[model samples]
Target: MKIAINGFGRIGRTILRQILTTARGSGIQVLCINDIAEPEMCAYLFQYDSTFGPFPGQVALETGALVVDGRRIPLHQQANVTALDLSGADVLLDCTGIARSTDLAERGLSAGATKVLISGPSPAAEATVVYGVNTKDIKGARIVSNASCTTNAVAALVQLVDQVAGIDSGHMTTIHCYTNSQPMVDAPRGDFARSRGGAQSMVPTTTSAMHLIDVVLPHLRGRISGAAVRVPTASVSAVDLVARLNTPLAEADLMVALRAAADRSPVLGWTDQPLVSSDLRARPESLVIAAPETRIVDSRQLRIFGWYDNEWGFSARMLDVAAKMAEAD
Candidate 1:
């Protein structure tokens, strides 16, 4: 599979790293990378990532291209998707985050990509897959989304509970880590709340993940609501999800159901050990249920704590989706 990545940000770079390291024998090759950053600078950033540490192999700039483990991958310092030469690419992963419109996303197809996968939620997406939740729906989808990290973290639990007891309604509060979109220092921006420095405070922000959940699980439409707060952290995000189920279960049975779901789904992980946010870094699964922290209120209400490596986990899922798309072709 020939792949092209549009953005070299958090998720994009991680996807490239995964394809180069863990996905080596999967027949996936990164044909080209298109980003606004200069080729040399992109090499530097890819070589040294603070959150995930250094690249496994040496990354050097050779003849205006990035050479990773003797493999040369050209980097194009272009923002216009239509100008990219992606004819050899079978899949284009648009981690740019700005390609939220169909017109913008279709540029990849126009540029010669067979399939386009957006890293984040996009309204134009034919399907928004949440890995274990609804990946089967992406069998023949050309332009799909992997959904947001938060949605991936919650979708499995939602589906598992809905199947076991049926979810009547739910609300999620995601304690998320700061992202590149936020300002590092207090600076003026359109939104007052977001204008505050990301590293300086816990800022409440609106999340589009709930809308994405509705797309993946239409039965939860109009029944689920959610909010997010970006805390001062470098990595790892947690979700506090509370749901009202149609059926009630004892604590022991509830645990059994959750464990069974995790066992059936490779994207979901269940752990009873007390874990901190740092312990979840580089975890490949979409969601890790903190079993010890899960609580049940009045039997009908359930509160679950889930953790995820937002960048790594989500990027891993993106690659999984890409592989599925490639196989379908």
Candidate 2:
């Protein structure tokens, strides 16, 4: 499948690397890139990544293209999506995170792409698929959303737990990594707390994952609520969840079921060791169940912890969604 990337930020660059490396068989071929960044700058950023280390493949820049592994991908620094020509693209990934509405995202289709995929939450999307949780909802929908990174982890974890042992209600807190949205040093921003230094201190903030959990797993609507804490970390985040289960389960039995679930899932993982955030760097699974931290109180109350490389895992799932979109056609 030939794919075009709209934004050449963290997610966009990672997606390209994943296709050539980890997600090699996903059938994704880079058709073109439409970003506001200069071709040379894009090549440089793609070459040296802070979280994933330097890209393994050769990265170079030509007249108007970025070359990776000897493949010359046309790079266009177009601020207007409608102005760029996106012909022959099986899917155009709108990773800009700015196209939140169907009207805004469908401009890819208007520009001649077959399908449009928003990398973040788009309640206006024809279908919002949290790949591992509800990719069944992705039935030939032209405009689809893979939701957000936190949403993917939360939905995958919640769905697994809910399927194994029934969950009545839960409150989740994601110990998330700070993004570019946050400031490097104390600076002016709308949200006072978020305006504080991102890598300096932990910041408590709201997450769209809370509301999006309801969108993907509609049955779990009103059952789960969550927030985020931006910790001082470069990569990898964890989900801290406390829930009351309909079927009261012991930790041992729950582990057995969850282990079995992870065994059968491609996008879910289980780890028994006492692993930290960096341990999960470059992990492809949306969430890895941390066995050592599982706790149960009153038998009915359940607590679970899941680790995820938010950037890598979310980009991996986008490939999954793109593949599904191509198959459906």
lDDT of each: 0.88, 0.89
Best model number under lDDT = 2
TM-score against truth, every candidate:
0.96, 0.97
Q: How many residue pairs collide in each prediction? A: 0, 0
- lDDT of model 1 at position 234: 98
lDDT of 2 at 26: 57
Q: Tens digit of lDDT per residue, candidate 1, span 119-183?
A: 99888888888887887888878898889998988887788889888999999999999987789
Q: Which residue runs does candidate 1 get wrong by more than 4 Å?
A: 23-25
List model 2 lDDT by residue over 136-245, tens digit each: 88886999999999999989989888998889999999999999999989998999999999989999999999988998899989999888999999899999999899
Model 2 residue 169 CA deviation (Å) reads 0.7
Minimal lDDT window, size 10, model 2: 20-29
Model 2 segments more than 4 A misplaced: none
